[model samples]
Target: MRRHQLAIVVKEKEYTRRIADYIRGSSFGDRWQVSAFTHPDACKQFVKQGYGIDLIAAETDLLRELQPELSHIPAIALVARLGEADGQFELLQFQALPLLLQGITDQFEGLCRKPVKGLAPNTNGKGALVLTVHSASGGVGKTTLALHLAGVASARGLRMLYLNLEKWNTSGLWLQPGGDAGWEGEGLSELLYAIKSGSSSHTSWLAQHRKFHPQLKCDYLYGFRNQEDRATLLPADAAGMVDSIVKSGCYDGVIVDMDDGMDELHYELLMRADRNLWIVSEERSALAKQSQMLHYGRQKYGETFGRIAACSEVVLSGINSELGNPLPAVEAALAPIALPLVREWRRGELHPVWSSSLYRAAVDRLCAYLLGESEESRIHAVG
Candidate 1:
């Protein structure tokens, strides 16, 4: 395995030693070949000595002094205080070692913006993981959680395309208009239309309409503006679009935001998905609806539903913050994961940052788990 070279330059000898020790002892040791330096001069000497470094994490002073030499290498500025980033990437000087590692990893991920070359050959035939997020009930914060997961992954440098196939398509409000699409991209609507009309290849259509959301750090397709366009989406068309996105190699994977309908379309999506996230609120009605939906799926599809159910996990979403434990009995009862209610979101405040929020913290853990799980699945496919 050709590990990426990472250089850590900090004035504090002890801090550099601790980080080096942690990286060597942790899974990061496999991905990163760490070279620690307590002085900028030594680091400069090493760089001049023809040491190839993929990334550098250094104190602001060292990074500034070495700016002439590191004009090309991706660098992370270690800062002691929080202030305006001023369009420069930075990480706090002190943090949990794991988070620090994750931060650095995210930067590396952003650098490649594609499946790491090392992991691609040892995985499934698919170009990327397929994640379908659906629910038996609506208004359970499914889209929000899905977007946040994508955002967290994007922030970490893992790429994904957010596809909202919901009928009403409320998630469109969050995505900014960019890429070739600009403000009037009509991505999902056009793609579905093209699919139904059999006009062009999926790859061409996808590339033509895909938009980049700057804030979320993920590529996304804006939903159909017209209700009729959404109504035209067929089960096969939807599944085919997702499959194309997965095989397109345009992203690390696809996050399909599904509606609350228990129909043929939903079943096709769930079955095709590599990972299924069934989002449900704590409301008894929502839980009942989910149970009834499953019952019907099993009664109707039998063995097929069984396979989908086996690969699926029920996640508790919109857990009330008023509660002491947040998870309550639901954690043990249904969900291996729970998404907390963001009171700020109720007031129409979009999350601008992920590093500090409790909500982001939970999402970071979930994203890490999903990526790790996907990695395991990829390796298993190799076996």
Candidate 2:
């Protein structure tokens, strides 16, 4: 067993007392060194001294007021409630999980196991796969598919980065660990600017300055949580920026989500992608939108535009199509566009069922697509 030192910072004394008492009684406290902090400045100073605090726990409000820069320390926020958050602190809300210390313990375990160095190549890492999920229509489950694919790829030991390109992002809201949520104030907008005008150091900066997960093998760089943050990426030179980022070799796969329609930025990301997935409902308009999106991609990137797959085209509620019937129409519309249907993302939460082999098989297929492996390769056991 490895020993880790942690810094627990909180504004409310009562909450801190409960958490610390639980820590002292738990088996984890016996294995790791622990310290506590009541002031944000104190924790900031400790981080500045290069003494790495393996984990940080604090309240959502405290984190928002003082967004300190401790690049390596993965911070967790203890929240009393859950809802929409506003401002730069939105990133911090992810850090705000439920007040349960057990979830905190689980998070701690995962952080310790994460790879602390640069990513190494695997089947999924050999060549970068940029899969962007977007719908011209909302409630189409684009983010759900993106998260499931990322999780499946990661569980199979691939190095992946999921980037939310939409300026007004909501993926972070659902993906928060232990119900903790918060924005880290960086995204494609920052990375794009840094890559073009900034020095080579920017690449290393993005890599080393990421939050880690103990349960999965993926690192996420989140987008703006509000419309304002999305505005920061405005007036971008999409083609030049995409080309530079794609060639940088900083990540093995870059999954992005841009708004629907044939905007400059949307086409820019689609053309650069090695695998582009367009998600839509089975409704007439959704099917039409899928057609338009595919045609738009071909127009922008030419005939060899990355592989295309239509997800949730017919499964969504309110569509008149019978179950599994829309697959034919979807395939038909995509034929002329040159994008083919690879798989369907079944609706609802994507957690794998332990008893069902069919669900497991679907996950394996997703992993195959993500790893770029042939049909013959065996699926790696999920850790």
Candidate 3:
């Protein structure tokens, strides 16, 4: 038996046709059986005839009229604009057709107890694992490691998305050949807007906006193109964006190259991530900054610190194998994963060189750890 049925009840024929067209062309159409009704009476009659309907989206007035009969099914009221409230169904003002359909689908899925077909069942019900690479000090090769980890994971057949949240990102220079040509659409700014406006089509929007990096063998969404756009992004907005991306179920792992400095959004992401890699350099200033960050996190977060600390790992970059005294406070908090500095890295090359070096082995170990695979298991399989 088909488990999902979507009924569209609206007064206007044009609106019904438009919505139906959008659904047919959307991801939802492949997974759902959709029906449209132009009259309230017709919809009620269809329901009265004992037809199975899992979800319904209707005009505000029609939704109110049919609420008593269709109270068992999940319903969403389509409003002309924002600010009007409806107690019956979640109020969604019609905006972009894709977003509208996505909003309705999200609400329907939440209300319907039965699982919908075609959507992958979240094994743990938390969706994808979000991994964040962050640092309080800059120039510690955070982006390099983040990209390498993502690339290695993708090569190992894990679906991954790399997101650079820095204010000024040179990801284009490294990931693409042309360097930001013909890729000038809204990108993260539009995504941020979609999240802020409570748009339901965040996943769809992301799918449409994401660009593939051939060399990295993974997909990525560009960060804010300009510095001016960075000011508008709030911490909650960033958190919401990440949540939507994870809930989309498009990737097995999402790697975030976070900006420097301890902002609310950065902390929120660290708290929410499945694993947080704090990259630091061996330089005195970088070590001092790392110590300060640790102290601040413990003092400010209190009990939440334990949860974040449990999932956190420190990686010390640009280090040579030498007996050097390190900060006791830093060393005690977390054992650092040592990533040796690569000579090719100084040439400012865009391509990744992971296949033929010790750095590659280090990155592979990191990847294995993130994927929860034991080194012994991997070795045994090889043997």
Candidate 4:
């Protein structure tokens, strides 16, 4: 997806830093590519010669200094205070960050410009981006969110494969019985063996064994059977399963649901994945486990410890209260993608959970990050 360019011109360097850092660490980081300019002329030069910016959010004083050639450019006034004299295009510099972002979103949407076209669907040739969903604590709704993410992306016309790497296969709970021949071919074990053994027909084996879930609009393997078979999974097995699946050019993205342990297989998978969603809950024990998990990684992997952290983001699940940040001192991107506890899901029905509008909206946000947001959303989504 093409990220829109934004130019932030505020003479106060601190102001620019505050806004830029917030956006960088927020979901907006993916939507906008922001550049800070302390001097007006530099910003003006960038606007005139470089590719034009999508929006110039600057102090009124800065905007006034620009030449008339830029008079018609999309712009918003960054002010210390709000007043009637200030047009709707003006945003207060001191308002809540979310409010300021909302103001920018509103003003930008109101612009009478060409629609922002979403880029073409992710081609299989691009090789699916591996997104691993993991948690330090179990029963945290990790697989559920992973499944929703895959379903949402698939619904957006992007091909997705939902793979469960769990030892006990918790994802099987959400999946209906007598469907897709669960664990029949003992999912991916043979495929991985073929890959490690250098069998040329491994790709053919993938297509034949995997079945499509009609509702998810996504494909999934029958899954692996027995802890003994799963225990044999090696660090190199990540490439054998995920990398091989991607190489097949069969899907745009692979959503991996993994167990809680940070074993060699888990480490290899997390490090190899393009993005990682580390699900966290409000419980103190869960948070402590996550913290310990990171501390352990830093100690065991040392120097190379932060690689996985760099690509990882926290996803808050079953959060019912207004607690500030779930991962204290943890840099969250876009308010942690808060998820609601759906009561209907307790009926032991997957359809009710999938159909829940609230659940779908939250998953949509995660999907927007994975696969670009839909055309209609590009035109009007506030968040």
Candidate 5:
């Protein structure tokens, strides 16, 4: 099936270009085909020529003029502000491009009531369980924990995928060996483009592009090769990419190594995750930072913070007998699971820890907490 087509009729070329770019980078781009026109007459002519346009967005005056001709199609009127008396037209602020695009898609979907074509059907009926490992402070062994979790799950015969969403791609340093042949094809950027373009064969592209981390014992997707690539991605784009990967049914679970931040992208992924782990060190400064982050989240996100807080488990990494218990305030705010520090980890050697008794025990306990079963019992069942 073909995607729904959208027409943008605005007098400003800059607005048209910006809107086009936004749509191309968003999930809407995958679900809908878009064309921009600087004049309403051009849009009207295109429609009159029997081109299929499921939705139209134009400036207030132009939309009022095009309404009589394109009345059957849903239309959104772009406005500078919300003081318009015309309740018949959907009014959207031009400054809020993301919101405006989302509103347009929602209006079109509601009015058309038609399913989009060329999208892969959910044949598996069940998606991968998403688990995000995050920290408010960096260098707290968050990525190490995430890798160990994926490795353990894979060792238990579960298909797993690890996604490193940090600003820089550093998993290669630990997971890939020195003599191994490095990645050859496109990385995450290409896959995101294929998804945004609504390609039906995106699963094939993902399979071709995914890198295998032999030590981690799972398939992994590297982060953007360039810092500029990170800047161009929006929360919605990440959401779309994750959704497509999960829907592919190529893995039983996905472990995300999230960057240390409270940005929209991080929040979106955290909210969508089936389980979330917040890793923090035993240091006073780390706990203080975590507390401040929690406060900021509550003040900014309000009710959304409640949902995030409910699903999250705080893990205290780098804990030793010498450190004793955490501060009363920290304990009250977060009852963290204690994780012992592995000596080899500090030396930048992780493969040996997979078999080390102490390291395995800690990870097994953490896994049991996440999977809601005794480590032995779960491993036996899975194996």
Candidate 6:
């Protein structure tokens, strides 16, 4: 990995110190050099002098002021607080992607953003890995798969994240009930508001809590809580947030849980994901939904959709047939219909107490697959 410096741009001395301290105090500072700027003007001067910066942690207004001179800099908003009134997601929508792309574009202007500095030629490999998990039909267990994949990767000691892109499922299942134990009103909704409003001390405000599972490694950013919040993360904004995380270099792999229903946001994510999983179930409805989704994907992406590199079918909650127990009278009723490669999961096989473990295994397989490994290839591996 190429060493990249973090340039902190803020006007106040105290604020600059706080930002510096935040970096020095975190895992990033231990390895990367972090510098502070008390004024936007000074930071721009540093950039003009060809003192390159790989990342910037700054305020939104402060960032805008430096945009012209620091146009080439990669940045992430250092949100100050966590509250619903802040419009955190909205802020992420506007700033994240443009800033990262700006940095990349600046670095590779001669090559048209190609060969991004410190990356392999012809390879957009910025050491950033993004994975998307989606099912055309609900109840096929995409969330379960996403959650478990994060756990397994984390267990293998890889820095990873699980992001749910649907408000209802994200809040109801992943963030609300499951993520609230250690955190206080902090979920995707709260995170979005925090960043947008530019409060203070927001690090802990965005992390999701979970029961321990050794195999999966990750953090999480849940989807919107309702139309109100979703409205904040418009298509452009979602793209920006994703770019921020990718440029942050804080994660090795980002697993996004896409909604089953087709939408502009979903389509946008499908374009960004390095690996896309099209999960389907044996149910006829699921098959119908998958067919429609596949049609849309192929139509929109052309041949690229076929060459997406990683695409698979995951059959979940299917029937269990014991050996020599006589097959079900109707084979069609008992088996998953013409499933592609499969990961069979049955509630009956898992103990209630091992729900977390079961979840971890599924996610582990997912991470392994994303990193270009087969399930039988390794007991444990980290990207």
RMSD of each: 14.4, 11.2, 7.3, 20.1, 14.5, 9.6
Rank by TM-score, descending?
3, 5, 4, 1, 6, 2
lDDT of 2 by residue, 96-184 (tens): 22324434554454344433222333223433446666666666656655655566666656555666666567665655554333566
Off by over 4 Å in 6: 1-123, 170-186, 190-217, 222-227, 300-369, 374-383
Each model's lDDT: 0.70, 0.51, 0.69, 0.69, 0.69, 0.52
Clashing pairs in 4: none
The list of candidate 3 runs beyond 4 A from truth reads 1-124, 179-183, 322-336, 347-356, 376-383
lDDT of 4 by residue, 45-81 (tens): 8866867788888887777776365776777777664
- In the range 1-383, model 6's lDDT, one tens digit per residue, is 44457776666677555545655665545445767887788888887787878766666667778776666655555444323223322112123333433332222221123322221221245634666777677777676656655666556655666666664553333334444423343456655665566544242232222222332335565345445776557765565556555554445556777777666777677667665666655466776676677677767767766654233444443322332222222211121221222333443332221255444555555445445555676533222
Considering every candidate listed, which one attains the maximal TM-score?
3
Per-candidate TM equals 0.61, 0.51, 0.65, 0.61, 0.62, 0.53
Q: Candidate 4, which segments miss by more than 4 Å at Cα?
A: 1-126, 178-182, 321-327, 331-335, 346-353, 370-383
The local lDDT score (0 to 100) that residue 33 gets in candidate 1 is 87
**Ten residues in a row with the worst lDDT in model 6?**
330-339
Score candidate 1 by TM-score against the native.
0.61
**Model 1 over residues 1-383: C-alpha lDDT tens digits?**
66998889988889988988998899989998889888878888898899898998888878888788676988777777532233345677788888778667755665556445333331246566777788888888787777877887667556778888888776655665222222354667666665666543554345435677777778787667667866867889888777766755456767888999689999988888877788878687887788888888888999988888876778877677677434333221253556777667677555443433777666665655554554233221100
Name the lDDT of candidate 3.
0.69
Candidate 5 clash figure, as a count = 1
Q: Which runs of model 5 end up more than 4 angstroms from their true locations?
A: 1-125, 179-184, 327-336, 347-356, 379-383
